[model samples]
Target: MANNNVSAICSCCSEMDGIFSRLLILTSSITRRLIEFFEDILLRDVNRLLRDSEINSYGQSQTSATYASSSRDCNSDTSIAFLDRNASDLDDHHSLTNSGLEIVNRNYHRGVRFIFKGLMLPLYCFEFAWGSVIASWRCSCYHMRCMQANMQSFVSRIVKTLHGSSDDIGWLQSAPGMAPVEDGSARFVELLQGIRNGLHKLPDSFVYLLIPGLFSNLGPLYFVSTKRFFSKMGLACHIAKIHSEASVEQNAWELKQYIEELYWGSGKRVMLLGHSKGGVDAAAALSIYSEELRDKVAGLALVQSPYGGTPIASDILREGQVADKETRRIMEFLICKLIKGDIRALEDLTYEKRKEFVGAHKLPENIPIISFHSEASVAPGVIATLSHIAHAELPWLPQFPGEDRENDDFALAARKVPVVFPVSAAMALSALHLQLRYGEKSDGLVTCRDAEVPGSIVVKPERKLDHSWMVYSSWKKDPEDSSEVDACEMCEALLTMLVELGEERSN
Candidate 1:
């Protein structure tokens, strides 16, 4: 009985061993197959990239040959140089011939033969390492080519749109350029000086509406200072309470309704002043519902607005750009999932969407428009500048109904903490990118060219102001300047210019 039990135990152990061996074999097989699958994919991609490179090189070689032929015609020494170069290349190739193999075979001792055979292992290892590097290089080249092609195509389309072609007349040619943009910088500077002296005050004939830009919802203080400044002058000033993260069309509709409500309540035309994406939204409102809004809105001043399109948006969201899909996914997640905002809010700003939207809806020629754009300083000192984003209100301790709230020591607990960030650094980086890549001047967000609305009076400020500088106050104030010209004064100057333009149009 004991012997039989021991044998059963041994048989069970043997069964477990067999199962483990089978599992190991299965895992090895799967791993080998996976490696082979990846190897095949790598080879395919590398080959495709190589073929593309070859095609491009062939064209370049043909061009070079033609040039060389022409040069040879001019001087026979050129042909001799070319021939000598080709001969040297041939000599280099011949250097890698079977001379080594012949030497090994000549000294074919048993030990030498074994050593030669053993060298195959290290040779294969070297081949694998070198192949991996080549594969990576080729893959990088492939993606680079794709990115270049995408950029070229995008640029070509933009160029075509800028310069009218036979098939499609450029939009820029027929769009707002028909009216011609007036240089109002000199006049703007004078008005700004008058504003600083508190001379050119806005008339009470219109209700001023300040529309905030993207992420305005998060920063409750956005346009708050500007509104307060306007209010101090006893002017009917209000910030348009619309979701800044909403699509341009959606915001446009909201803005239209808001303008109508303001007009009906106050019995006055709304003077719309918008910053960044807000400007785009306001313009869309006027364009889409021109018949309705033309009578309600007095004028529009787009401050640092990308009315045409932003290259930053185009590059990130553009198809076929390097890591385009990945970048879009990241942006979508951040905008939609994290911020609870629509992706279309950002997508609408892209070149493709802007082109389509602008083509469909044109801004009314009657409304006085002012395009304001500034270049941000890319100096290292600017990076240290801080921007006031919002205030964090801390929770206070609850008191009884009859308790004196003013005397409570915990009243100070609910004190608002100023939230600040180094937004200038980000702006400087973006401005640097735009400057380096496109040789375009930008306010760290919108390029000067893109901000200029063709039909409007363009205000190109000499002062180096960033995108955030127009709306948010900077922590560091220049003490050297005796006259401190704030955002309020700048805004007043813009509106003053708009008023003049309106009178000019009327005359």
Candidate 2:
């Protein structure tokens, strides 16, 4: 009886050993297959990205070739100026064609890629947990190391392909052949002081065109107060009515026509002072239509303009960037479907687009250009400030069928309300991000480096002012606001400096 019991115990022990062996084998096989599958996926994705990069490279090469051919054609033509205009139009079309669908498709794929990664998150976690266990038992970290190496390589490749070659990715830095930036801070101060003392006034010989930036159409009060202030000072100031969300070239054409009309009507040269993207649009107008606008325009003041490029636009729109597709999709929906604006309106401000555009069309050296940029304070108090973005008038309610007769007048009156925004908080957050990530100083949207236009007088103000500070009124009063350096006085100073620069250049 004892021998039989011992035999049963031995048999049970053998059976358990076999079961454990099979389980080990199964787990090992599953782990190996998962590793292989993930690596294969990584390989395929990398290959696809490479192919896309090559395709984009080919497209850019073709564009350059076309531009060269057009230049040659223009040079050969007897009517060079007219042909130059035609060539510029062709270049605009090419730019639209190249960037439009390609950008959309890349963004869609990026969003899809994000969804895919989220869906596979569980699998990824499981694999990592299992991988660690396998590594412990086998005492070999080779498989995990290999997977990590591949992942790092994959990420590096994506960044490389997205930004192009290392040499081509210097959009944040000043471009080669760009004119050196000159400090106009001292002169600007003098001018500001002069304005405050009523010693300096903007010349009445020119029609001051105050061009507002992106989405300015929605904000009826944008630059309205400034215009009123200018009017009070007996200046012929007018706010441009162009669609702020239109493409740079499109707006430029409209601006050119506007400048011509202003010049023809008043027999006075138009002095343009554009804020944010409006500055970019105004500069584009002068650059593209230099021949026609040489005598018609006196000067340009690009206040907080991203003349070079803005990293906000570039990072959001650049392919292979993390969350690039998701951000682009959101922007496209907002700008395209919701606002009925061109996506190119945002794209044109990107580092890549700005580099290309600025390279192709140089700003005419004849025009006196002033570039003004300031840093936004990211202090905690700034987050609490509110800004007026828009104004809305509620429709008057008709007194119908004897309803609430006593309060009818109160109820029926049209309600005028200001649309306020926490723009200061938004600016603070973005400024913090830029500072943390790139260590670059920005006015919430445009970095100091980006706003400094080549060959233009650059003014770096010590005052901490956000991008909207110039155009939008703040709910919270600035404690440091001096009696002399208000927005209107600052405008007067900039134009006065510009007028002096023009005179000096003419002499």
Candidate 3:
């Protein structure tokens, strides 16, 4: 009986160990799949944009040489000018997107290797270590706690070094026909102070640029969270409130002048770090500004900027479709009231309007840029409770009685019968809109491809990180190894770019 009991206990231990091993493999596999999905989405979007540009170029070449070659005539004709403008826009768009894609691919392979070699295997070891502790209660908890403490200390050391004070933050400063960094630190400080002072009496047309995505407008919140992350690195830093009712261009111009007045006026070159739409604005500014102003820009760090535009936006603007009353109301609230009233009014502008502003600009090839992006995933059990609440509060459709419904024209058009039931239609439209709004791979608003710029240093954080949280700068008391890795990567990239810019000036 004693032998049999011992045998049963040993058998149970073996089963648990096997199960643990399988769980670790499953988790690693899921992570790998998520990364791959992001890569595919980004690659496909880029390839499509390239194909479209090529086709458009080919089509234009087939047109009469007289129309194409007559530069003065082309400038005069609005239609020709429109075509020419779009072509140029498309060309630049293609270049930036392709460049961003290359960066994404390079980092993606690195991320894959990091996950497999650095994270997964280590995680497995951790699991085994924990499992051994679980098998015996005698001093096991104490041992586990010690191990955890050691890991925490290791992580803290790395984080502190990478995100340390920016007191020595260095970049090349350029004046007209000259570039130098002798007074880089002093100049940056003076520039920051001037900008802050200028913001006190901001012009009505002057708008602080708002980048779209989560945490974009959470000002103080973002500062507290991210201040330490980049503070010690001597990078340029400023905090400004975006104005209500200002156009995107107006906002861009305001930021442009602010940087110009602060950095360029003082003979200091500048670097702009824009997240999401802010990135678009930075690129747009670079395109339209004078060569002198452009020359002053050392680099642009775009964190998940969608330069190619978003498919979700395309879905929202689908032609000939009338939005349901509820949908329209939500749109009005989000666009007119929230964005226009409180935030900048750019979000309310039509895609074509936004495109028009962006269409007029092109980034100079000489400037180096780094882009960071995050992958989107729909977790199986995760529910977007906010969206659900928004849906629940919407008014029911009147035309279709005995049913709770939201009636968009698209939903109405797809009906098999003359009178679609309200409840069924609402549920259908709700599901469709939810999928369009929250479904698929997106960091809320921007797709992975749209989030990153081509040829920029692209860092896709661990899965489950939302678009807004990618730039989160909160300090961790007991930071994980992965977190330290992320901070180090960002610091290394930023430092390398600054070094390169400095070198460029020396030459």
Q: Scored by Cα lDDT, where does model 3 land? A: 0.49
List runs of model 1 lying over 4 Å from the truth.
1-178, 385-418, 474-480
User: 138-199 in candidate 1: lDDT tens per residue?
Assistant: 56655766676677777775664333212211234355435577788999889888776669
Candidate 2: TM-score?
0.62
Least accurate 10 contiguous residues by lDDT in model 3: 166-175
Using all chains and alpha carbons, the TM-scores for the candidates as numbered come to 0.61, 0.62, 0.42
lDDT of each: 0.77, 0.79, 0.49
Candidate 3: deviation at residue 438, Å? 12
Model 2 spans > 4 angstroms off: 1-154, 157-174, 386-419, 473-484
Judging by lDDT against the true structure, name the best candidate.
Answer: 2
